[model samples]
Target: MANIPAFKLNDGNEIPSFGFGVFQIPADGTTYKAVSDALKLGYRHIDTAAAYFNEQEVGKAINDSGIPRDQIWVTSKMWLQDYAYEDAKKAIDTSLNKLGLDYMDLYLLHQPYGKVDEAWRALEEAQKAGKIRSIGVSNMSPKLWKKWAPSFNVTPAVNQVEFNPYFQQQELRDVLADSHVALEAWAPLGEGNQDLFNEPVLKSLAEKYGKDVGQIILRYEHQLGVIVFPKSVHEARIKSNAEIFDFELTSDEMDALRKLDKGKGMHDPDAPGVADTLLNAFDIHAND
Candidate 1:
């Protein structure tokens, strides 16, 4: 377990730049074992969500691993089904109880859907009560930020979005920076998009640095100041994902990777039917 570097949150707490993402991990006992393996390999940050349906398993791994709670940064999210102010508050408590933690390092609204501002209000109150250290949103875009900005008293500490070489979110990044909101990238390895691994620029840099294309992309994003947490089911890939800290990518190499951006990635966060989809997805199990 080596010392991993951290980035300061607007709230004054520091978050490990690299974390273990459990987006698609099954909740059927696999998450517990896999996350325990990651913690054993020195990963102190674990990202999960109620939507992932693995918070209980993730919490089990963290607690069972014998790591001090303060040393581990745990982040979770509230599902759209729990977006009402009162429901959000209850959901927060439910997540805390499930994780078996007194406080969360970061808690996000899983999507920018349904009573978002109201949901945020619940998060703020929780933070004030010491139940949550930091609060933010996921799948947020600059357009959505504008509509939701006026109501915020405590600006979000982070905006986790779909960011990668193939879909570099430079414009939204700048807006978030102005508000001191750190940009966190999800699906950073292109969300299993093989084209990302096949990019010629990434391939070249990988060969030059004696690393894989994923490592090159992760290093490049870190250099760009974007917090990245890539996910994998294999122990080898989990260990390999954390190895980006050992190398440095030249500015020119970074620029070369930057050129690979085609502004393509996941769904638009501000799509017209988000609320409708949110309402319809009440029975959907995200990581079942």
Candidate 2:
């Protein structure tokens, strides 16, 4: 097993620096196998969510892998429909039941919308009851942070968002740094943007380091104190994504990659209509 690094959260819990995500991965056998392969490749962290609809498969893979539960880190989120106080409380239990776990290592409010205050209160209550180790929010902006920070009894341990070479999120980084909250990158590979892979700087860095463009981007973000979990169903790609800890990028090289930030991401939570679109678009609870 590779000696992967970990980042300490504000709440003092640590998360594996590199892991696997099951965002678009289907539930049927695919998520289970991908998660199993990732564990075999020494990935101790597995990121999933209620909206992803694959927690059962993830749980099955983890349970069958024979790795002790404490050796692995699992994360799930509360969906928009479950934002009410009671709904949020039940949602957490539902995730636990589906994942077949007694507790979750980390849990997040999936978005910045809905009855956020009520939902966050539920998360806090769950943490107190030992159902969740660390509680946080995803896709939150500074504005939204301000809206809820003053009222929060427990500070968010992390803020996961769409981050990549093209959208570095320097402002959010500074904000999170000030509060000692970890930043986890979701689209850390630029979601396979052709322009990003074809960029001269990234290409040159890959050549210099004898790695692929994906590796270069992931390593850059990792060096910047950002945690990343690049999702891929392919076994080879899952293995390749974990090969970043062996190399380090120098200051100038880090600066070169930092300059690629375009100051925006694919989805802007602060933007108008985004909340409505996300809140109304999906029926994640339909199959239940």
Candidate 3:
């Protein structure tokens, strides 16, 4: 397994340059085992969300790994119903209790819903109180961040989004540049998008470099300064994903991958039905 690098956050904290994501990990023992495998394979950063409902299992896996708490960086997000200030505050404690951690390395607002300002307020307060090391947003685009971020006392340290060769997020990066916020790529492998890894450009580069197409794309993102936490349950894949750091993607190769961008992927936070579906399915509330 290759060692992963850590990047500096706007808050003066360090974040792993690469990580393992537990988006759809089952709540059963599967999560514990996979997380344990990732840790043993040298993945120090693990990203999970409250909506995933596997916090307890992730916690157990970390505890069982015998890795010191300071060595592993854990991140979880606040979901829809937990957006209000009071709920967001409580949700921090809830996630902490579930994860069996003294404090999270990072926490995020899971979606763009009403009461987001209040949610941000809660995160800001928590950082001050030493509950979370850094705070950020997930699924928030530049357009959305511009509208509401003016009210934030502490600027968002990161914006985790669906990023891959397919959706390079050039426009999003332009805005985040002004705020100095990091862009963390979720589903960094396009979640196995055939068009992504199967592109002739990626194939040619992978062959040229004697690496997999996934490694080529991850290297691309790494050079572009986007944070990526690709999820995998297989031990082989988990081990292979960390190998990108050893090689460098040439500028020409990076440009070729950039041209492969289609700017489309699953889950658009700005889409019309997103809010309604979340509100109905999750019993979202704007109040504490």
Best by lDDT: 2
**Whole-model Cα lDDT per candidate?**
0.88, 0.92, 0.88
Clashing pairs in 2: none
Name the candidate, 2 or 3, with the larger TM-score value. 2
| Model 3, runs deviating above 4 Å | 283-288
TM per model?
A: 0.96, 0.98, 0.96
Report the CA-based lDDT of candidate 2 relative to the real structure.
Answer: 0.92
Between candidates 1 and 2, the lDDT winner: 2
How well is each residue in 158-261 modelled by candidate 2, as lDDT tens digits?
Answer: 98899998999888888888889899999999899999999999999899999999999999999998989999999999999889988899999999888998
Backbone clash pairs in model 2 (N, Cα, C under 3 Å; residues 3+ apart or in different chains), count: 0
Whole-model alpha-carbon lDDT for candidate 1: 0.88
Q: What ranking emerges by lDDT with the best candidate at the front?
A: 2, 1, 3
RMSD to the true structure for each prediction, in A, is: 1.9, 0.8, 2.3
Provide the lowest-lDDT 10-residue window in model 3.
279-288
